[model samples]
Structures are given as structure tokens and as C-alpha cells.
Target: MSGSRIDFRKAKFLISAPDIAHLDEHLPGDVGVEIAFAGRSNAGKSSALNQLTEQKGLARTSKTPGRTQLINVFELDEHRRLVDLPGYGFAKVPLTLKKKWQQALGQYLQERSCLSGVVVLMDIRHPLKDLDMQMIEWAVESDIPVLALLTKADKLAQSARMKMVNEVRKHLADFGDAVKVEPFSSLKGIGKSKVLGILDEWCKPQWLMDTLEQAEEE
Candidate 1:
């Protein structure tokens, strides 16, 4: 592989798993690269994914928060996958169900060996909630790169948006190169290219690059 750009528009729904056990059973062994998308309920996670893949209904947008109750996987290629994790916090679901969902989310984050990157979407108007911070910290601690996407950037004025972006950058500056923050709007298509570029970088792991190089040599 030449570390080529991935055509995210080609993303297709692969499978949905309710828990890590099912995920392991379905995918088995955690062999390839997986970039996960995580955010709170109604944080525009589905919208961001739809925009990224250019599929209007790929991730199933819903007016109801927490409709994405399962671990939805989308395949870009055999060696690469995009995971749509269930939304956390602010979902009006039952207490027991909420706890189960949270458990699954935590398990996936802590145990998934193939998770190469995480895109944590947050509302620009209300960025960096406690859950969001925890997600970022977990990814950073796990040595997985994160794209802290401030979603719905169009809701704010240009000045405000830029200011919030800077403030978030400063707040997360301690993480250094492990995290990258950006303003994104699914409606306006803002920052889509930049986000995709970052994802393209994540898709080309050193192991995959080495394999591609060896294949070329053969």
C-alpha cells in the first residue's frame, strides 16, 4: 500500500454489535485499523459521519438522541474500518440501559486493540463536557490519536467560532500532538477536507505501509 488517500464516500455499512463480545465474535481478533467516532447524545455524531461518507443515511440520523444504540461498523476497505459508537450522556433512556451502554462504550475504548484513532464530536456551542473530556483523556492515555471535532460550527458567529476553537486548543494543549482540534459543520461542509486528511493519515499505519512496500518489492 502506498499510503494512498481513502475514498470515504465509498464507506458501506458492515455490521452492528451490541457489546464487545459480539464485536469480537463478528470481526474476530481485531486485525485491522479502526477509527472510532464518539460523542454525546445529539452531538451531531451521525450527521458528521453522514457527511464524511457522503451517504445520506449511512449512520441513520434521528431526531431522537441515542438512537444509535449499537456499535455500527462501516468498512472502507478490508484493512480499514470506521466505527460509529453509541452516544453517551444526555440520552433519555432508562437507567439500566444507560448503564449498559456506558459499560459497552468503556469496554470498547479500553480494550479494542485495533482502535487507531478517535473522533470525538462536540457541539461548538457547548464544547468539552465532562464525558467529552473523559473520552479525550482515555484516548490520549491509550496512545490513540484523537480529532476533537467541534461540531455545528455554523451555529456561532465566525469570531465566536474561532475563539472557541482557540480556547479548546489551549485547554487541550497539554496533550500536545496526541490531539487535534477543529471546527466542523455538517450542514455547511466546513472542515470536512481537513478532517478527512487527518483520517487519511490515520489510515496508513506503519505496519500497513511496510506491508505495502514489501508487496511492491515483490
Candidate 2:
């Protein structure tokens, strides 16, 4: 399929509920690249994923802060898995719950060798919080590639959105090697192409790359 014609289809939920400790078990053992998404509560992580895949209600999107208590995993073409980590930095949530989710998310991020990259979502209106910075630091320390999505871009004016993206990029300059920041809007479809392009990089199965290339020349 041509890249521009890309639309989410034939996508089904493989696993709806996944706990922190059992995330590895829920994942297929065949060993392929899996991209994970992380963000603070109500950061539009789920909404963005649902929009990307064009699957409404695919991942749970909640209005209440700290609603996602577990890591949710969604399958893409049965070859790639999009992992959704629980949110953080919602001080209104209980301390015990926060710590538990944090440890689970931290373990997954730090130990998952199959994790190809992490898509960290931040609200365009309020892009970088202290907790968001910490997550970037963790990805950097682990040498994991991160793509920052300044979600809810439609909520901001066009000029303001550009300014916010630049500001966020500057803010993340210290971790340049580990992350790339871009503005995204699930509502306006802004940055959809960019998100899909980044995902394409992860979709290329290295094991099949040579074989596909040879076939293409035929």
C-alpha cells in the first residue's frame, strides 16, 4: 500500500487488559519491534492512538485524571504491538497507586529489549511538566528512542502551535539524542502524516527487509 493511502484497517484488539507485572507475558514471544506510548494523566495518549489506528474506542480514553491503571497493549497487523503505559504525575491520585504504576512503567521501559521506541505524549497547551522531563531522562538513560507528540494541537492557534513545538524542542534539547518532539492533533489531523512516518520506521521488520527489497526489484 502507498504510504499516503495509509488508513487504519484490519486492526483488532489483541489484548485489552494488561497489568504491569505481566506485560511481558501478554506480548508475543516471536520478537519484533514494539513501540510504547507514555504520558501524564489525560494527556490524550489513548485518544491519539485511537486516531492513528483509525479505530474508535480502541484504547480507553478517560476524562478523569489517572484513569489508566494498567499498561494496555494494542496489536497492529499482528506484526507490531503498540504498548500504552499508565499515566503519571497526577498528584490528586493516591500515593500508593502512583508508586505502583510508576514502578511497573519504569520496569517495562527499562527492561524491554523489544521496545523499539517510546511515543511520549504531552499536551500542546502545557507541553512539559516535571514528570514529563523525568520520563525523557529515563528514556535517555536507557538509550531508547523517543518521539514526543505535542497532542491537542487543535486546541491552540496555528502560530501558537508552532511556537509551542519550538519551545518544547528547545526544552528537550538536553536529551536531543534520545528524543524527537513534534506537535500532533487528533482532532484536526495535524501531524498525522508525521506520526505515521515515524511509525513506518518501526514497522519495517528488519528480518524481512532484505527479502522484501529483493522482491521489489523483480
Candidate 3:
């Protein structure tokens, strides 16, 4: 898999599960690799997904925050997937609904064995809220690699954007190599290749590469 790169444009919707139980029912046993995208309600997660896959409407973008309430899965291939976890820290939602979403999110992150990595998107202007830090910390504690994507970079000048990126990197430096930070803009296509390259690397764990190789041999 050395020279191979995933064709993100090939991604298609797989399923949307409201909770881990349903996710297990549909994608039983959690047998393959899954990289998840998570963020606060207004962090531009959907825009980033659509931009990354070169699809205009892959992940639904909304003017209102907290519109994504389910766990959406998109398949890249038989053995690879991208998961859109529900947006967190939205204030307007009912308490019971919010608690339910939070519980579902917690269950998926803690129980999913095949989750390969987490892309934690944040608005460039407001990079690390308490909930955002909690997400990153949870992933790190689980030994999962994290990409702290500073989205909406187009809202800032280049120098300011890079400064924010560096600041985030500094704040998360304690996590060492487990965490990586990059500034991104879906509108400007900034950092798209870099982000894709990281995702491509994650998609090819040694076991998955071996499985792909064996499949080809068969």
C-alpha cells in the first residue's frame, strides 16, 4: 500500500445509526477500519467532509448548528469507512435529546474497536472549547490518533491562521505524536491535500494492508 492513496471521491453513504446498538446491528462486529469526524455544532465538519471527498453534498451542511443528530457512516471501500459523529455542545436542543446524543456518542467512541482515528474539527476562531478538549483527551486516552482540524481558516489571514494552528499545536503538545493540528478552509481548499495524506496513511494500517494484499492474491 506504499504508493496507493485512497480515492476519497469514491466515498458513498453507507448508513446512519442513531446509537451504537444500531450501528452494530448494521455494521456488525465492527470488523473494519473507521475514521471519525467530530466537532462542535458550528465547526464546519460537514463542509470539510464534502470538500475532502470532492462531493458537494456528501455530508449535509446546514446554516443551523446541531442539525446532524445521528451517526452517519460513509464507505470508502469494503474495509474502510468515514464516520460522522453527532455534533456536540449545541445549546438549543432539548436536554433529553442532548443527553441521548451524548450517551450515543460516548458509547460509540468507547466501544468501537475498529475506529482507527478521530478528526476533531473546530472553528479556527474558537479552536478548543471544553467539549473539544474532552473529545481529544478521550481519544488520546484510548490510544487513538487525533487530527485537530482548525476549520474555517479562510476567515482569517494567513499569518493569523498559522498562529492559531501553532497555538493549538502548543496546547496539545503534551499528547506528543498522537495528536496533529492543521488549519483548514473548505471554501479555499486549504490544507485539503495534507489532511487527505494523513487520512490515507491512517487507512493503511499494517493489518488492513495485509488483508488487502491477501484479497488481491486470492
Candidate 4:
């Protein structure tokens, strides 16, 4: 995260996993940190991920919802990762498959030791649904930090966008202090900076801790 900017043009395909056992093969132990992008099927999660990484076709944008069915992993470097989690709440898949996804996702969020945080995306027009709240609350319950992005802010007027952002922030306050909500638009590149800033912070190198310690001693 410190050596160079997070250019998704440089993001190589790591792997896609249907379960945690496969994910563990690539990112074992606490050697690296992952920030996951998760949301409902039509929330524009893939688009937001591509915009942040600066790659157009990196995550595949499609009109047909529920195109992504696995945990897609992309690496910024050896130390940092951006994970595109399967969208929830409306995939045309079978009930058994849907249940499988939910169980796997729950395990990944709660048990993945190196998972640093989660970036939850929701459409600005429909900010906080029960499913969205459940997702955010799940991460909070796991003691994982969450950044909720109100995607597609470009569709709304500035006043409406700000109002939604405020309302989201206030409602998430019920979850915990770790929850943060912001307005984002991938098409217009709105809030990309904030997303990147959080990634860089989470993926900050281990050496920075030494510098802080020395400064404190001085």
C-alpha cells in the first residue's frame, strides 16, 4: 500500500474460491491483509471495486444481476488484497446454492484471521435495507471495521445524496463506532479517494509501527 498507488491495472488475478479452504491456500496466516467489497446483487459492488483499482473490466460489469458466484481475489501486492465477495439478496440461483454462499460468507467474515475490514456497498437510492443492516451488523459483531459506501450517488441530486449519506451514518451508529458510511459513485468517480485512503490505511506496512514507536520515545 505504501510503495505505489493502488492501480488495478497492476492487480493480477490471484484466485477465486467457493470456500475458505481454497482462500487459505493463497493467503495463509497473517502475512497479508484483505479488504472485502460486499453488497446486494444490484448494489454496484463490482463497479465500485473496478473504479477504486482503476481497471475498467477487472471485475466485469453486467446488467444481469448475480453474475459473481465466487470469492474473487485480486492482489495489489504481496501484502495487500482486495476481495470481491459474491453479492447477496437476489441471485437467480437455487435455494441450496444460496444457502451455501451465505454459510461460506459467514465463515469467511467471522473466521478469516487476516481480514482487516469490509467495504459494504449499497445503492444510494435505496441506502439501508434489512439485508444491508444484517451484513453491516455481522461485520461489527466480528469486531471487524466496516465502511459502507452509498454507490450510484450520481443518480441523485446533491441535496438528496447528502441527506441519504447522513441518514445512513446515523442509522449505522446503532451498530457500533466502527461503522462508517459515505456516498460513492463509480461512474462519476465520486468517493474513490476515500475508498483508496481506507485501503492504504488498512494495508499500511508493518514498518510504520517502528517509526511511531521511536517518535513516541523521543
Candidate 5:
């Protein structure tokens, strides 16, 4: 059977809050795979995570931007974690606090060795804002695998959505084709296959394979 067919059924909500690393600490220590989602406020990050996991209310949703002020972690299994990062941009907060939040997020993204990949969610209409670019640049510099989810596809016409996808790809080309960019809508169930397929690949625990391969090489 095709690996893409593998079912990533929804798991229980392990925890919730604003701190990313603190939430990570509450996670299973033996976690072998992790895929984190990051995006701006109201970019549908929580909704996309909920849809992908096939679990409603896995992550809290709010009409208010920046409601998710901390990094939320959802443990998928004994060995996997799906993280929901705080939204950036137009958070309507103090400048100093914003910088602090950004720094915390940056530290996690750049330093988390356990992170397998990052799912960067972008609103279909406004995909690459300045803050979005910063996050993308950080991921690029860290050499982390990233998949762009062009969310809210249903809000646009079919042709317009495709154009937006191409534009996002063009903007991200500097990061390399490994940065998978695709249109998606949790409401419409579009791009579900693409997202899940990418997750399946990242969930493979390549570090473990490499460890075994190296031992054999020795």
C-alpha cells in the first residue's frame, strides 16, 4: 500500500498554553518525530491543525488575533508531536512583549534539534508579509524542512487560488523546492492529501534510521 494512505488519526490534546518549550517539556521524552505549525494571528493555524489531526478542539480558536500567545504542543503518539506556534503580525500588543515572543519563538525554531519539520501556514490572499518572511528566513537559515499551507483557499476563486499558490512558490523559491507550497482549506478539505503526505514523510524518524545505518557502517 502507498505510504500516503497511512492514516494519521486524531490523538488526544496533551496540553495547551502560550509557552512553546515549556509545553515541549510536558511532552513525551522519547518523541522521535515532530512537525510544528507557525503562522500569523487568524491565519487559521489552529483550524488547520485541528483538521489535519481529524480532531476538533485540539487547539483553541479565536476571532481575536494573537490569542495563542504561546506555543501549543499536541502529542500525536508515543513518538510524535504536532506543535502550534503563537501567531505573529498585528497581534495588537506591546512592542517589547512582541519582541520577547518573537525571540522565544526564534530560539525554539533555531535550536530545537528534535524538530523534524515546520508547516508554515499562510493566508491565501496575503501569503508573504514581512513577519512571515522573517520566520521563513529563520527556517531557511536553520536548514529545517518547511511546508507552506496556503490556507483559506475556499475564500478565493479557483483560478485566483492557483495564481496565489504560484506566487507563494515564487516568493519561497529562494528557500529551495524542498519547501513544499500548496493551497489548502480545512473547510473545503482541499490539500488534505498533500499535507498528510508530507507529514507521513517527516514522521518517518530518519534520525533513527541514520543511527542504525551508521552503526552498520561502523
Candidate 6:
């Protein structure tokens, strides 16, 4: 994004944490820029994450819904990271556990200063259900921008894909420019570069920007 392009292909697994405290142990004194992936349990959020990093099996795809209960982190460098949050709206989990997850997620979204933005994944066919909207709203309220990744785009015909994008955008119009929606299918590798481009901006800090520009000059 804008004269700086950090490579997503360089991303590697950082850690899998059940909560924010577990994640902070891996970071350097609780500091770093990170983008998080958030969505419903069956929204293919993990698949989209693996595709974004160009690493299969990175976030763990599953046939059973709600398999990802951990907050998985992927590291691009010492200072940049990607977070895969627990998927919501799964009935199989115990009510107590669900409440815990909801509480942790809300706290993370509100309090984590290192969090740069979030990629809200939703299946293309069932775009922006109540839970998905709630996820986006959580980020918007926290003054964080969300990139809505409409996954499984390959499941829809080309015409349907465009319609879904516009529909998602129209519903998000009230949020002004805080939210963005794009078609992405992890299986077919659709919208890979676009997601990476957004993440590149998120990953860059002032010191890193200086390094990039210095390299460009040389």
C-alpha cells in the first residue's frame, strides 16, 4: 500500500494462544503491529488466512465447524504479525466456553493497542449475517478498520460474485470508509495480492518504512 510492499509470503507461524496473555509472552515486551482475522465459525476464515500467508495448513482448515478455538498468530518479522481469532456462532461449544471467548474477543478488540486492523471473513453466499455484522461493528466501534474478505468466491458464478461485493459494501456504507469488502477464495487463490497489499500497509511501521525507502534509494 502506497510505495511500501512487505511480502506476505515471508510470513511464518508465531504461536497459538487461547487468550491475549498467552500471545503477549511471544511478543517483545507487548509491542508490535498486528492484523487480526475475525468471523463466524464456518466462514472459512482460517482458509483465507492460510491463503493470505501462502502457507497451507498454517491456520488449520476443518470439516467440523468451530474447530479453531485458539488465537493463532503468524509472524512476518519481529515487529509485524497476523492474528487468527476464535470463530464465533458455534453451537457445539459449551455455553460457558462461548462466553469466555466472547469476553476475551471483546477485550482484545478494545484494549490491545498493537492491533492495527482486522480482516472480517464471511462466506460469499451468506455474506454479513448477524454475527458478521457484529464483528465488523466491534472493530468500527474500536476505531479499527476492517477488510471484509468474502471467502469461497469460487463457489459463486462471476455475476453473483460482483453482486455480493456490492451488496456487502452497500450495507457497510453507513460506516463510511472504515470497512471494505472483497471477493476471496482460498482454494482457488483468488484475491491473494489485494489482501497482501492491505496487510503490507498494516505491517509497516515508521522505522520499517525508513528501511524500505533507504533500500529503494540504493
What number of backbone clashes does candidate 6 have, counting pairs of residues 3 or more apart or in separate chains?
0
Residue pairs with clashing backbones, model 1: 1-212
User: Could you tell which candidate, 1 or 6, scores higher by TM-score?
Assistant: 1
Candidate 4, 90-202: lDDT as tens digits: 66789998998887787777777778889889999987889888888888888888899899999999998999899888877777668888889999998878877777776
lDDT of 6: 0.83
Among the numbered candidates, top lDDT falls to 3
Arranged by TM-score with the best first, the candidates are 3, 1, 6, 4, 5, 2
Please, what's the RMSD in Å of model 3? 1.0
Highest-scoring model, TM-score: 3
Please provide TM-scores, in order, for all candidate models, with all chains considered together. 0.96, 0.86, 0.97, 0.88, 0.87, 0.90
lDDT of 5 by residue, 1-218 (tens): 12233356655667664555566567655347778889988789988987887877887888887856787777666667787777777457899989877877777777677888888888999888887877777777777788988999999999999999998888788778668898999898999988898888887765655765677689
Q: Give the lDDT of residue 123 in candidate 5.
A: 91
- Candidate 2 versus truth, CA RMSD in Å, comes to 3.1
- The list of candidate 4 runs beyond 4 A from truth reads 1-9, 28-30, 205-218
Model 3 C-alpha lDDT per residue in residues 94-186, reported as the tens digit of each score: 999999999999999999999999999999999899999999999999999999999999999999998999999999999999999998999
Clashing residue pairs found in predicted model 5: 18-70, 18-71
Better of 1 and 4 by lDDT: 1
Runs of candidate 1 exceeding 4 Å displacement: none
Model 3 whole-model lDDT (C-alpha atoms): 0.93
| Residue 209 shift from truth in candidate 1, angstroms | 1.1
Model 1: ten consecutive residues of lowest lDDT: 1-10
The alpha-carbon root-mean-square deviation between model 1 and the true structure, to one decimal in Å, is 1.2
Give Cα-based local distance difference scores for all models: 0.92, 0.78, 0.93, 0.81, 0.78, 0.83
Please, what are the lDDT tens digits per residue for candidate 2 over residues 74-113?
A: 7765456788888887668778877887888888787777
Candidate 4 residue 111 Cα shift, in angstroms, is 1.6
